[model samples]
Target: MHKTLDKLYAGIGEAGTGRSGVGELCALAALSANLYTLVCVAPWLDEEYGSAGELRRRIRKVAAALVCRLERETDDLERVRGVNALFVLSNTAAEYEQKMLDLAEPVLGRYEAGRLTAEAALFEAEVCRMMCNCYCLVQDEALAADARTIISGWTAVSPSGTEGLPVGVALARCEAAAAYADYTGDERFRAVRSAGDYGTEEPETICRMLELHLRCGAVSDAEALCDRIEQDAATGTDRTSQVYRLAAKAACELLRIKDAGFSE
Candidate 1:
């Protein structure tokens, strides 16, 4: 469930709200989606708790507040504008079943959608910045590997099996792929394929590929791509270029680590 929450937050963070109204709407939708996630997840908690009904009541109170907030914020927008919002809601709800099974775990092992949704509004302008920092903090060796493995497994699963699963599985897969590529050297893990049925074209996909090249000691290729990406960035406001710049920085870090005689 925390994974779901994190992904939704990440999307809103990526949207960069202060830049445009569309971005703000995306944040609202991301938050609202987390609320909706709680709605579906709370019902199951009824069967799991000693005071199941009471716990559900509390959870619903929070969920209802979130839903009402979303409705108020997004009512003026058309269906197209609400697409990301809807995605957020469904993805959060999808994690409910699995979270129920983890009730006994320490640290609760769940992301609070309700709380995250609330925070999304309070920190709209800097959401993405904070998300990147927060993720960097929590993404240790074990957590990074787990996140990657789960995403790889999720993307590789049959569509038929994923039926009635969260609709945002693709987005989740993308998030996981990004982290996996950064923290681990496993290049087989890719995001969605291209339209040519060739290879992944997702913005983050470029980062993974760049990182993979660096990991394999393909410094020349990585350096060349970095140069090309810098040329693309010169025009300004290119998302792909921004991603490439980050990847290039990572590649440079890898080079330094190697120069320092870091070993496997």
Candidate 2:
């Protein structure tokens, strides 16, 4: 892990000093994405490697360096990706959450009012997902309300046949609704169910729907989803298949606990 971190840091440092050409910017973006994934899975890495504190320190350093490089970036798409990376990093390093939010606010405002380019729409959806995730983590009423407004705006403008909605937009709405449901103890689970009906077979989306079903005491539905996931895993032949298999196992355990009258 340290060797990988060293390589990532060196790449960022080299890119930071170069002229911000497309190649250099692409390098920085790739580094940022790698760091974001590292932060997201930091807990599991810590468990596996047993250097939690030092690993976290290294992650913080790399994230800070990447953010510094991105601060000088001029491209809107790259800037949005940088912000999203920072948001993911902040989840692992909670102290940076407010700082990330402050950074994102202006960018989000620009995208919100801009003409509806594909990039602009993507930015809004990503920001809405960030806001919803933040609200779920911290239980901030204002953030939740703002996220709700963005989601409502999407719904208001969406065609009656939501099947035509872009997959990214639909997934974002599904996640946002799931987050709201999580915060409110299943109050918005119906919204999650509705948003999740866009014909996506994404594993994360399926897992989220399964979890929400459990939250709302829909044991039969959750079991069916769990069975589907397990069946897919059984026939699959990739890393994702293993991930789905583990998720299914965990879901099964959760179901057992629920049936045993244990608090989740």
Candidate 3:
């Protein structure tokens, strides 16, 4: 569930709100998603604490407020955060589900109105992610495709050095690479395939890169990464078992890929 929360929060943090601690609201959304998942998967937690319902209310209220906050945003990145958070927080709600495209258009309009700069291109990638998720929530395949087209172009160039990108940009690219693969599969593997190097080296990032390597017929890279993770795990890398588990998963994936004749 935390994994789900982190994935959802990327879009939110990148574009949740412009106010001070806008990132906190992004966290609020992640908390809500994780809690909701917990409650669904383990109903006892919900019955015992009664926190899930309250958390849900808080997420919805804050997300809606952030959405309203976006109205006055003139800055591209801040508006991106607000807009991204809005849909993520309210995506499961039926009333707000239909508003995705309408909500996204003004931002799209802004992009189409002006030429893409290096800065604008960076933000545009994040915006496309928001659109992709919103469209998936609403089952709007057409708009999702439109967003994917934009994503493909940006992702194809694989920010090899990724300098000047925002702090969370690498994580965002990880998500983008996953999403691109989700939408296009083999036909767009190059566009979606993560470089597997550079950016953040946190366990989560490494886990994702391993997944990408196995995903794109780069099993040897995944195997090599698994060797490193095995050492990290043996070193008692952290309080959590994520790294160890990711190592096991990577090793398993390598075998599976090998058996399936997947290689680069």
Candidate 4:
């Protein structure tokens, strides 16, 4: 048990260079998704299953097509906990960089140099935020320092950056950019608010801003921002408008999307 923890700790250093391709980043992203199950979901398993060995025995009674299972042998809580707690935190930054590079590589290799498309930058921002959450989960926050760097790469501007783009992609970029400034600390909010990259008044942007303000412990400001979104939402009566309203409502609760549960 001691040796296992020692190994996890020793491997905590940054792993790969930030040069992974899109396909490779995609693979790591998938790994992170599965690992998320163990970290976030496994712990919540109803110890109702009894001892770990009994838990394994009961799991074998299932007849569904589920792709995962708790370990079948050992019952050591420390070892079970250590694998999930440490694995992602140890390599989050490296995976973040690779995902960032995957977004940047195409722009660099093609007609543009160093410029990021709104869609690509948005995905990168998502990865950055995901890394921050994962690091925070394990109490290893040093890697979250990448938030500022990641946001800075969002050179794409709305209209210009989002020109001719699908409505879905544009909306997602708004959320991602808003979150980028969010995790960057409050000082960035004003800059991002006024930057008009994804457009400041967007409900998605406003909701994210509200959540950011809440995260910064400014509940009053978040409420004010939520009100502003509600007011601005009167500009349309289309389906998209309705979607924005729903997203705003959900985003108002200071919720963070988490892993899918593995336990019944």
The top-ranked prediction according to lDDT is 3
Poorly placed runs, candidate 1 (over 4 Å)? 1-149, 155-221, 238-264
Tens-digit lDDT string for candidate 3 (1-264)? 345334433443323343424444544444454455445555565543235665566466556656655556567766666566566666544455545456667776776677433366557666766766665666567656767677556545653323345545654654555555555452453444344555444554465466556556677787777666666634334422333243344344435434556657
What's each prediction's clash count?
Answer: 2, 0, 5, 0
Worst 10 residues of 2 by lDDT: 18-27
Q: Compared with the true structure, what per-residue lDDT tens digits does model 2 show for residues 1-264?
A: 445434434544442343333333333333333333443444454443225565455446545654665666666555655555565456556666666566656665665577433465555666666666556556778777777776667656653213356765555455455556566554633343343344545554565466556655667776777677666635544333333344444565446544656333
Evaluate all candidate structures by whole-model CA lDDT and list the values in order.
0.35, 0.53, 0.54, 0.36
Steric clash pairs (candidate 2): none
Candidate 4: C-alpha lDDT: 0.36
lDDT of 1 by residue, 1-264 (tens): 334333323433222322223433443333343233333444443232213343233233323333333333422222222332333332434333222122112111222222232232212212221222223434445444444444444456643223233322332233334435544555565442211111333334344445445444456655655555455434324433333344344344344444445332
Distance from true position, residue 192, model 1, in Å?
9.6
- Candidate 4 residue lDDT tens string, 145-209: 55455544443343223345444344433344454444445355223322223346654345445
* Candidate 3 lDDT for residue 222: 71
TM-score of each: 0.27, 0.53, 0.57, 0.32
Off by over 4 Å in 4: 1-118, 139-142, 145-201, 218-221, 230-243, 247-264
Q: How big is the positional error of residue 242 in model 2, measured in Å on the Cα after superposition?
A: 16
